[model samples]
Target: MLVRRFKKSLLVLSIAASATVAHAESFNRIASFGVIHNLPEGTEQSQETSPEIIAASEDGNTLVYSDSPFEALGFVDISDAKNPVAGGIVKLDGEPTSVAIGGKTVFTAVNTSKSYTQPSGYLMALGLQERDELVRCDLGGQPDSVAVSKDGRYVAVAIENERDEDLNDGEMPQLPAGWVTIVPVENGQLQCDKMTKVDMTGLAEIGATDPEPEFVDFNSRNEIVVTLQENNYLAIIDAASGKLVNHFSAGSVELQGIDTKKDKMLDFTDSQTRLREPDSVKWLDDNRFVIANEGDMNGGARGFTIFHKDGRMLFESGASFEHQVILAGHYPEKRSGKKGSEPEGVAIGQFDGETYIFILSERASVIGVYRDTGDAPEFVQLLPSGMAPESAVVIPQRNLLVSANEKDLIEDKGPRAHVMLYSLTDAPAAYPQIISTRTSEGTPIGWGALSGLTADPAKPGMLYAVNDSFYANQPTIFTIDANQTPAKITAATLVLRDGKTAKKLDLEGIAADGQGGFWLASEGKTSKEIPHAIHHVNSTGEIDRTIDFPKALLANEKKYGAEGITLIGDTLWIAIQRPWKDDPADQVKLLAYNLKTNSWGAVRYPLESAATGWVGLSEIVSHGDQVYIIERDNQLGESAVVKRLYSVSQDQLKPAAIGSDLPLVKKVLVHDFMPDLKSLNGYVQDKIEGFTVDAAGNGFAITDNDGVDDSSGETLFFSIGKM
Candidate 1:
């Protein structure tokens, strides 16, 4: 009887532990609102637009954001929440720097500066219910940030007499020093005549004469905390007295294990001495405040810091936040030489009796969520945002968080500036579809641009993936465990040639050889001096041998060369990406190389005709007597049409000699990938570069992030089930 009871208790404990682990809190992206949609009907949709800073109405059903490029303030009606409607835009007389909402009243700081030395701006109030401007007051200098007190008694403005970067390389002390403005507000009405300017000079260690106040926030005690970003200073002012209470240098930090080069690799062994030139500041509580250290001229600590009101240091992130970005595959290798990950915006709010902090990385386009523990904040999770999320607003009452993204890539024909919405709930997180675990030495197995995938024949959920030319100096193949909820990369192998890391190899396809080696397809570019070749690499990633195409095939090769490879017995099949010079219109070649005969042959595959863009094959995989290939168009977002999987029978894959007439193969559409791409509610990504079937016959697909170079860096790795 005692033994039975003990076993029963152990079973109960195990079940309870599983339930507790499954009930953790999470935030998942719910909707995305493009700022371009807020434009008036007569305006061109292609015009550059941005949502730099944002605020929400009292009821949390409406949002207001500042768009500096169009010199206007935009609004979004989130009454439906998941499906936001355009609430139109309001044209302002000057550039709207920042916005805040008190009850139903909207307040904006407009920068009307004629020059850096001759600075000017105004504080304007507008009634949201009336949809008109209520009052305007001339602020002493150009304003950058605006905040309202918790008691709704007053408003604080950071008048940043900004400096011109072209003049003297933007070294400060350009005169017309900046200061803080305090104005009384009674029942949603601003009393501008009672406004007072608080001088903040002779304080900072650098540029003490010119204090450029960058951001401001009000504490529960009606005190304001402001950040002098360019001056590397933080100041506190009493709202009632308009007198400076305390000030301190934002300080510097010694960073270890950081990537500080734009050398096409994600190596985190370097170090740097960085200044915490914070861009955004927020009060976590009455005693502690947090800052997003986004450096300008000299320093960016690449993380965040927490400090007490009495100038006591509480906590410093110290490259930890940026390291999380690396684990999520959102590290911007291109910005390694500058401020890595560039934490530019911060927001503090309470939910379910717990205070949470949100830090936005402008370059990496991700948000780090943390819980305020009074001492060192506890990291919760990472959220994917739109390009360059400049500001965030949290509506805890409605369990919603919004981000204002400021990047508009109209010229590059990429995703436009957007306002993304996320909701905290019991649902699982939809982001970080793929992540890498830390190595034994505490370094991340850094990876991105996963171009191809092939499953291990014997392992149930194990698969291998390869990187493209994005990491030119670090060609790698990653081993992934797909049984995990969000598939985790377990290990990495460097592709080596002659015992050295391979260079200039654009690996686009992988196929497991009958032996313990693999066949890799290189998508070559003549302009860049990369060759289109089939390389056989052993299990340890050593190049055992290579095969180049014959003269008949090479004579008509284009930049879009071999994309995918598959092995069937002694024959190897390669999928040509597009129609080469020698192929018929709207047809690509399935070039075959026979290892037993040492000869090359080809067969044509019909391409899907797209209405807006050209369609081509991305991958080829052989299972049983059938071969599956991915065919997609180059378009992205709503313009995408043809991302699908097609299959062909092996009996019809007979290939002729490369110099002779080629036979066309018939293909049947197996699956349309559009629904999978739209599952997360984000804009559809352009590169659906990888597809494979695990040993269990479950199909999987992944998209490339381009190493977060002008990209959102959201890798969608998910299972499609048995194919």
Candidate 2:
């Protein structure tokens, strides 16, 4: 009896011990896939093998990892977390530059191997279910990356040659040269067909250089795409024949140390070339795509890049980015902080009568307010969100506040991801903690944390994002809806996918259009430096169009990024974050395409030098007879938010042309103070994002703390008496 009693006690203790250990293990938050892409420095095209992550799947089902630092393949089964199990390891002959996955299919892009003697690898396809080798197609020279067709019928592989040690940086590669291999997935048919070499060297010869090739993707018919790179440019290509259609240049970067590794967050630079790190690309409909870039501006500033599928230089603006994160201590020369301040994630949404843009600032734990009337959106600051607000958005009818907590964008502090939901009670503007992705049942899936977010009424649902990786990589996208209660997720999608074409998205930015489409922007910062693009997936998950911006405009604009893409009435407006020398005055264009005119015009916002008391353009809106613009401090951080109003006469854009300086409406004031900031983000936190006019003819705008750190953030509303 004594022995039995002792055994029972011991057994109980053992069970309790085991339970304690299990509880001690931290629950993996949302996986953050590095949002930015980093490549080897200089002209030497070497991709990191292990130290980086490409993309991650939703549901935390799978992960597509690369060891460009070691040039190998790593697969992890994220299904049973608490601790993700390493699925298996595959040794590649060369560097696996990019990877994508869908369902059970995995596609990987292998570049020049470190072994040197081994034949340059092309692309490998593997089936995750059977652990079977689907196919390993070889290629000549070195391939940049691969893209699969929507139906999984074709794979578009962008290939290039190794830099000749003896040749100068400007000289072209003569060996295998540059080409996109369109191979049939079933039998690898491209091997037998006469090899087709499309001359993408046009952008190169003209100075787009070291091109980062990209595709907006194709469905059943011929898919059109845009390619970008330094000295090269944004080019429209015929997917079938590898034929050059049309394109525009982003600019040039001379022979220098252009490191693709140190890049942390999105900034002012080209996506394809060197200005920005080109990590991912998404098609925003069929005509345009948003490219997320991560890199140090090679003499240019850093940010995201936008391009037309037909290779037109869309427009780049500093006002577009959700936010930028530079390492706390590491910065290029004197360009560390935003005018000396740090910024975080940018949240935007629509609510109430007036358009309100709320900004969440780190440290200070406050929210920035940008109020928009008929004129431009004004700026102000308020206390909302939590201690550290990562990202925020506003629900249409229900005036509630939602926020993503990303500890800190630059420091890599605290937990990976956290979120706070708040509401505007009859009391005052105070935010309380609501939902969290880190709970045992919650899935933060934020690779780095939370980066950018926007809402589309078309889905009638809500979406939240974690900066999954790139900036830190492992990022994830979590979605919520109006019907959902706090802490509840209606639907969600992983950040990574099995790319059918040559596009492996490192999800960075999000834009939703009223027309039933959600836009996802990616940052690709590897060898090509291709500009970022905006991808629009319909209700059924089919991409319609993508607007590819020229790589030249990307590099020259300082960064080729379309941080924020929106529809102001029928016209499409894009914001390019960084312009050339971080000088907003250098012509960060606000390109407007008038659906009625069937033409496009540039509205230049001299951002860097726009301190003339005039509001520099960003977080733009068109309300009936008046044009609303928000000038969030791009260079000076957020010391002052100058929300200036401009009137665009319906008659001015008609037969005649009313370009940049149309007319200032001093009387028609929108937001008066620097409304887009939380106290912590300092002057840099006020980045106004979402804006719109509702049925009441009242304008609604939402702002967020640029994901600088994670406190709490908020979404405010204002009343725009009438249109």
Candidate 3:
């Protein structure tokens, strides 16, 4: 019995270690292509564009995606996988909903409907090599998804004919009814006259008279599976004869341990039963298929489900996938009230004899990879995608996976719509550089928007980080163990005031008080009633005291204040984010408060001038005799040119009165963070907000994800080695 117990313990340790270490084979992002690059020469660059559904050519050298906002089809040449070139866009007569490739031809489903009541569309085929329209078959309804059979003999399109949400709160039964259209393909050409229309009315229990098909997929047996998202129904039809083979309710799931409130907190104790209104379906084989439960109208299961062709539930992800997303710090807390990390797209691929399943989370902007093990799918790794991933296409032959990200943040001046590429390689996963561990109740410790970091005074590789105002109601200090490959967040301590979670604190910087306490810097916006103050919290996370800025400094204050805090002897130094009304051009204040004297003074820090946007200080940390600061710009992607680390000597700590002329400190370049940001193969992030040096003298940096709001939800945490 003793030997058996020892062996069991060893097995558990082995499994845990394997999970933390790198896998022999994994997927890493190789490149990212912005769909705006495919805009025509005469088109305005500022115009909005979105890549909704994507397809790859047979040779795997070219990619075609539907740009609905531009009303065109865009193409990309990936002959050089690492550097994709624009193949330009083809103008279309209507909005292209989806696209599928068959040999040297591409079939696109175009929505020509003028209104919800009068629905009409067509399936247009164009030559991939010549870029010329070959044929068009009137689909007679608004189509949503299009798929070509594995045998390349048939094409299936789902005629959604969706209802108007303004009509009756988006309720069903207001439609002219939807159906499935299957067209024959002979000798690699679409035969428009031989299209078959399959009637799907009165087949579903909900909205029986108005069936709205959302997505379609084909199996090896030439059978098509259709998802009626609003009706919460699934139907299987024979593509060859247009006969109903089987149909069943998509069903509901009892979800537990989920966040169901938009209260800006990561509470995962709620329970609710919701319908699995699946959006995208893909067949694993002729016998089984998978559905992404994206939910619409009245339901969203918040995960994926697998079902047998005969309607047996094989596996239900429930809240497991969302939990993993929470651990990765990609959970969209703003979407907590609705479908948390709504799984909307699913793709299946067989690479080197191993079948893998890719599930795209629409809100979280992350892809969850799983290996199909016949009975149950095993969770693999999560890949960071562009903002709002809408569809995915896997090129197994080239060991490549591509995702179509439909969000174009042109209005917000954020990252544009992008299509990201990843390749399977013999290396470790490079994302989620930091992840949180489970709590005592086995629930993931939810964390995001890590705005500030401070190293534990005595423990090497141990750090504490604080979230910004993005999580306003649940101000938290996360304890991270950086000794692991992917740094692990071990515990979360909520910043509480009088036994309740603190309110109105926009915490951005943290510093160890050296007496089992911490000093927090809260950036304030007076317009929102938040004050620019410093808070002292006990080891138990209870606020003990608050220090407000002097009236002299407040006279010319801006909303961007006190971005970072650090302690040196009896003085606490703060780095202001941007210039105030009283400050000179290209300079910001680094305020100093003497605890012993109870007085405030200031020094001016010179900022690098940016060509496009303004530059500002993000973080400040004191190590040995140097004070390191993180200086960055507000630009993203290729426009970001200034994300660097600089340091000033502690001897330059002389400060003058708040209204006096502040002494300008000379800084020496410590490092350039642009290369580090590009090392992940993602677009350059704008906020590199946190930096700290551990007891062992190693430097670590982190980026804020803005709580996944209009962002990619990728929190990059990495080390700069000994500093």
User: Judged by lDDT, which candidate is best?
Assistant: 3
- lDDT-based ranking, best first? 3, 1, 2
- Candidate 2, residues 405-482: lDDT per residue as tens digits? 333232322222223333433432222111222223322211223344454444433444324233432234445332
Query: Which RMSD values do the candidates have, in order?
Result: 7.8, 26.0, 6.0
By TM-score, the candidates rank as 3, 1, 2
Per-model TM-score, in order, reads 0.95, 0.37, 0.97
Model 1: what TM-score?
0.95
lDDT of 2: 0.40
The lDDT for every candidate, in the order shown, is 0.87, 0.40, 0.90
**Residue 656 CA displacement from its true place in model 2, Å:** 85
Please write out the lDDT profile of model 3 over residues 567-673, one tens digit for every residue: 98899999999999999978999999999999999899999998997999999999999999999999999899999999999999898999998999999999999
How much lDDT does candidate 1 score? 0.87
Error of model 2, residue 444, in angstroms: 30
TM-score of model number 2 = 0.37
